[model samples]
Target chain A: MLDHPTRIGRLALVGLGLIGSSIARGARANDLVDTIVAIDRDPAVLERVRTLGLADHVTDDLAAGVAEADLVILCVPVGAVGPVTAALAGALKPGAILSDVGSVKGAVMAAAAPHVPDHAAFVPAHPVAGTEQSGPDAGFATLFQGRWCILTPPEGTPPEAVARVRGFWEGLGSVVETMTAAHHDLVLAITSHVPHLIAYNIVGTAADLETVTQSEVIKFSAGGFRDFTRIAASDPTMWRDVFLNNKEAVLEVLGRFNEDLAALARAIRWDDGDALHALFTRTRAIRRGIVAMGQETAEPDFGRRGAKG
Target chain B: MLDHPTRIGRLALVGLGLIGSSIARGARANDLVDTIVAIDRDPAVLERVRTLGLADHVTDDLAAGVAEADLVILCVPVGAVGPVTAALAGALKPGAILSDVGSVKGAVMAAAAPHVPDHAAFVPAHPVAGTEQSGPDAGFATLFQGRWCILTPPEGTPPEAVARVRGFWEGLGSVVETMTAAHHDLVLAITSHVPHLIAYNIVGTAADLETVTQSEVIKFSAGGFRDFTRIAASDPTMWRDVFLNNKEAVLEVLGRFNEDLAALARAIRWDDGDALHALFTRTRAIRRGIVAMGQETAEPDFGRRGAKG
Candidate 1:
């Protein structure tokens, strides 16, 4: 009802998966947008979106979906951003803002920039939140509550467009931060991309071990491997695209990880308990910092004990 | 009132940390033991144990603590098992069942077997359960519910002793599995030791990154690094001992991990999205197995969203 630019007359969400569906639900719950137009190439996804009543209008046609939308947010995999943007860019209303929820900003910005029309703004975003689950059913209205949403607007982007996008994320209960697309990719490579790669790699290694039975790994996973499995179980297509797109930063960080792991392996082999203890002790402080910053739960085992039921 | 072999007249737990105190609480809660004698070299731990009423008797004297106990379980770190066992073996009651809850069974068996008297039985156990938090206050009665407890009784051990130890674990709500000490160490090296080592290694890697600010890592940890931090935050002394004692199996498994990771990295560098997708998809089956087997919670984000309140 307010005349502020933050309020959207029509918001178009491309792809009705977890992030896209959650954005639709959150926007409606927060009254940040008057109407939502849900679009997906997959007819099944569009049907599901209609059944769930996630948006005011649903369609498989990209151009129709974004026809009159004041804002369009691409919530598909990073690899799909370019093609989807190109297909719908001409249909976008003049002065509309184009944003996305992709994890890697630099690559997404590169892919999406050329397709964005001069009349529209492109603001790349990465919400640092998710469950291992995927699909529309996996998302909730509160998925982004108390989580960080990073925005990386390309150079010369209109400040008003970025503000409106930031305001939309803030309305969905996210703390917004701004940085360069390059810096965002670098930070996320260490914090997210490489971590996921290692988790997937280790789970694969455990699965392929000749001496250990699969049943044994599955049964005794609670020790620590199960934690890795949770992240490793994340959406495969999305993660593959993440690694494929953010190759440089992920490889750079992974190289450091391998170097550090080699030293730890050496220390263990040589019975350097003090070295192991020191590193182990130092790592606890980082966990404490994360918990203290409200980015993680202080509850033991992520409060899984009570959730066991 | 039950006269089962699992019932203990006096059970001595040699350390009052997370695992030890949890045993005390579980034993008392299920009425598996008549009395628990809590022993620790640290006065503060003994005081905390007493204040929490975790055991019937609390003392710093290892010898005095196990004087007439029918079952003596060494609950200290694996590195301290030898010294603690040697210090108390002579004071053990005749025909007592000597056992432990160490993570690495083979090393613990080698350390404690020589000191144990002929009249006693040495049963090494590794309960595949725990949280990151430690100390008496962090212990809970339901810690081992629906968890696995692996027992590695050395050859020529009395069947009655193994049965009693197995029965005791069952009373604590654990499903018991018996295997050779060597296999237990190998199984645990992959399932627990190396997972923890890499978790510690990656967390250290992130903390030491010159390019990324520590504040940034802490702020964006929800992306996946935080799960690693949970396991990396475990007891430093205990984890150090696990790595040192289980060196051979851990290094062997770690070598495999490094090799697998190299292949995964190559796939990423060369843009083999198909290979990355195949591995990522395969790992999700293991997670489903863990959850189906009741070793993990099926809830998303470990049900942390609801716990946030």
Candidate 2:
């Protein structure tokens, strides 16, 4: 925003859910784009998007939406990336920059590149911002503020196109960074994917316990398990799709996490308090680092929308 | 406080640390006691007790403080229950009621009851409330509000004594529940101890993952590890004492948790999405149950005492 013009001649959102709607809000609020178009298969969703004024035009036809747009951002789940790309390929304008907001970069590129127009540039992005909530109604214009948006541009993607996509995100108040697709996958595997899986796994584990009742698990979650439940409560469909699409990355990180956790279990089983205490002490520094990084705002409530009460 | 009595004559806190000072604050706020006599070897902590307006007198002599007190509450770490009880046994007043706020009840009662005077009543209590903070400065009067205080009085412990302890807690706005020490230990092993240990374990693992890098872990902690770090940042001395005192119970729950987690890890390794989704979906219902039961406030936070920025 400090450097680029706040005007997008044409914009196309290939999916109209939370991320897409959030982007729509950001673009509109910053005057970053004009004559925006949105596409989703669900007529009801399209109707809601039109009513919400996330885009000037709403359509089920992906091709029609991308035909005259300067940018087409795929906001669907990772698994849908391929099909959406194929559907919108021929209609994408010459020199158009195709981007996405999927959580996994390698998977997104793998799914979308073959379908990308030969003359168009493709920039794959994963913005490190979201709430447990979903749907167009849940989005707000400032959702991306102070959050990281990593762009993974495959080799040979033109710099100009990358700059345009980066500029668009910058206008939305995000700090944009570039990373190789492989590195991005690794970083996210540790930061986002592993954490989500751990949360999901722990909650699942608690649910399966016979001695400790579910009601009890719920009742005293303040001890710590409650945090996992909140993350595990995230939209299942999105997560299901994420795991399926980022299988290699998620599984890879999960393997390391399990190894790390099993070692910890061994320590606790052996009553290795020194090891436990030492590890815990080191982790305290990480929390300080997170507070320093603008990625997480540590106002308690763990950066969720609001306080529990 | 619907059934609570009018006042306390002489209230004695067996330790003047976080829980003790907090109890002192709550008692003072409710005008539950005429005088608060605090017993702590740490003169500095005891000296600051009345700064929080929770204590009227401070002494390093446990026996002297317990003398003339009708209500004596042990606020020492679980491991220290034995020595503290022995030191104060000869000094407790006739017909005095005794209780504790230890996380582990069975162990505390086992260690403390032998030293109890025949004319005095021993009621081991655990208020399911705390913050990561410690010492007198962290004491707050509202710490017990809307929280649970589980009183595990020994069989044949005077009913009148139990009622008085319950009344004291109720006056502080805590909902009092009665359970056997064994049941209390088992429930707490899962609800509080295991979860806290798991959090400490995961945080430790993240801290030691030199290959993954610390800055990366901290920056991306918004994903999940940040929550664990927060929990693990809790008082090291208190947690060390918990693990040492509640050894058997914590180990029992840890075994169950590991078995369940192993099953989940295998399922993830096998890419069994059905199993994962089924468990994930089941867990969400439990969270809803927590919210519905008011165990977890429906607000996004778990009722942590913090403001959202």
Candidate 3:
């Protein structure tokens, strides 16, 4: 923040959900912008944002929200990016930078870049952090602290605009990294999308079991199923749009996941204890690497017992 | 430990790994036992246990370790339970009670019940808690606090002996529950065994992906894959034996899980957003139920960032 190159005169945040509210709270807390405009399609959400005093202005009209904004960030579900961008294109200030907090960068770029104005710069970013909870009520200012915010700016993007966006995220307490949109989608397919699908699938599977009652599963979840439940409990609308928009990458990685899963099933069926042992041992090193890199906590049982409200 | 029953005169631990060492430490800290004997087949482990002052006596000889002990607990891998129990069957004191800490209940009962002398009692228990760690150095005195310890007593076991074993686990900071050995297998297969298998399979899948490098997966694991990695990194030999010995129940629950996953995949392919949303919402309730039951943490992100060492 000490070496920040520029400040946003007016920042417009569309879709006042968890990500958008956190951005508003962080900007206000740090005084990164002179004025904040919050917009959401749901009138109830706009009312809640106003009651929370999360922005200087709250509105349901998109054009009015972005009329004089120097920076506009769309925080809606991935499937809504095209329509939202098209609606704001006519009202967006010339030379203003437009960005989004979408999980799938390639899909967002493809859907939004066409609607962007010629004078304005469009940068797509994905912040790799969140809890299972969602909505404006679930947001906090420090959600992005010590987390990675990946920016996927398309070709011919202005360097100054990109740096401004990077500085904006850095001011909000995030480390920024730049990568091609295609690479971003591929990496996220492995790290986020497939993992989420598997979690949802497993939870659904456990629920449908005839031999075990659902109450029993909940009572004894500390064994391991509790972790999957946390991941599966994420916002459904956002995740559904993510899978639908990023179909190719998600399906491709899922295919690879299935092949590996089949091999493991075979190992268990044929009593290949050595293969299972070797694979399990190799995975321990990966967990150690994540802990050492500060990506995950080294605390036993995820420090669940010592958590504060 | 106040208002406890008769004190343990001599307690013998058959394996000096995480569970056994933890029992030794817990017993010594609470003054619940007079003499603690630590037994391990590996001389190095025995030497380490002795160096740590984790036991009153440490030895590699099975006969010498269990001599005149009032309580003996087998803490080895499920596959080794039968052999360890047979070896100590003749050495156990006439009135001593024998127990084990194995995930699979029915198999442990079958493997060790035949070796129990008429004068000695055999009980099988499973503590539904653990970190992604193992070995002597990984144990602590309070590992069982706020955790569920299930004791599966076979029919015709003496009621007085069952009460004594129940009191022992309660004294070590666990809430104890008793059920038939057959039912315990089904419950654990759903709660622990199948969950571990799925975690192991998914971690292997991520590791084997061609589109994403292993290092990239580790770097971005905070997205969701990191949670699965913690469960998959558990002791390999112990899990291998779990799936092998509890084959029938694990396979049964696994079949149900596969069917559910296939249905979910179909929903995604057909773009049934409602179905996906409904399932995701239902799973959220299960997670909430777990938090309410005090089995899991309600803290966001498992309170990983604020954990103490």
Best by DockQ: 1
Q: Please tell me which predicted candidate would have the highest lDDT against the true structure.
A: 1
Q: What is the TM-score of chain B in candidate 3?
A: 0.96
Chain B TM-scores of the candidates: 0.98, 0.94, 0.96
What TM-score would every model get versus the actual structure? 0.98, 0.92, 0.95
lDDT, candidate 2, equals 0.76
Error of 1 at A64 (Å): 0.6
Please list the residue runs of candidate 2 whose C-alpha ends up more than 4 Å from where it truly belongs after superposition.
Answer: A1-3, A295-309, B1-6, B300-309
Shift of residue A306 alpha carbon in model 2, Å: 7.8
- In each prediction, how many residue pairs overlap at the backbone (N, C-alpha, C within less than 3 A)? 0, 2, 0
Residue A267 in model 3: shift from native, Å? 1.0
Task: Give model 2's DockQ, 2 decimals.
Answer: 0.44
Deviation from native of the Cα of residue A96 in model 2, angstroms = 1.4
lDDT of 2 by residue, B116-173 (tens): 9899999888888776667887767877776678889888988888888898988888
Task: Choose 2 or 3, whichever is better by lDDT.
Answer: 3
| Candidate achieving the largest TM-score | 1
Q: Could you tell me how far off, in angstroms, the CA of residue A66 lies in candidate 2 after the best superposition?
A: 2.1
> What tens-digit string does per-residue lDDT give for candidate 3 at B1-309?
444674688999998888999889988887788899999999889888988999988888898889789889999999999988999899888889998999888888898999999999887888777788888988888877767889998888888778878877877777888987777788888788888887888787777777678878877777888888888889989998988888888877777777777777777788888888888888788888888888777887776763111
Model 3: docking quality category: medium
A200-300 in candidate 1: lDDT tens per residue?
A: 99899999999999999999998999999989999999999999999999999999999999999999889999999999999999999988888888889
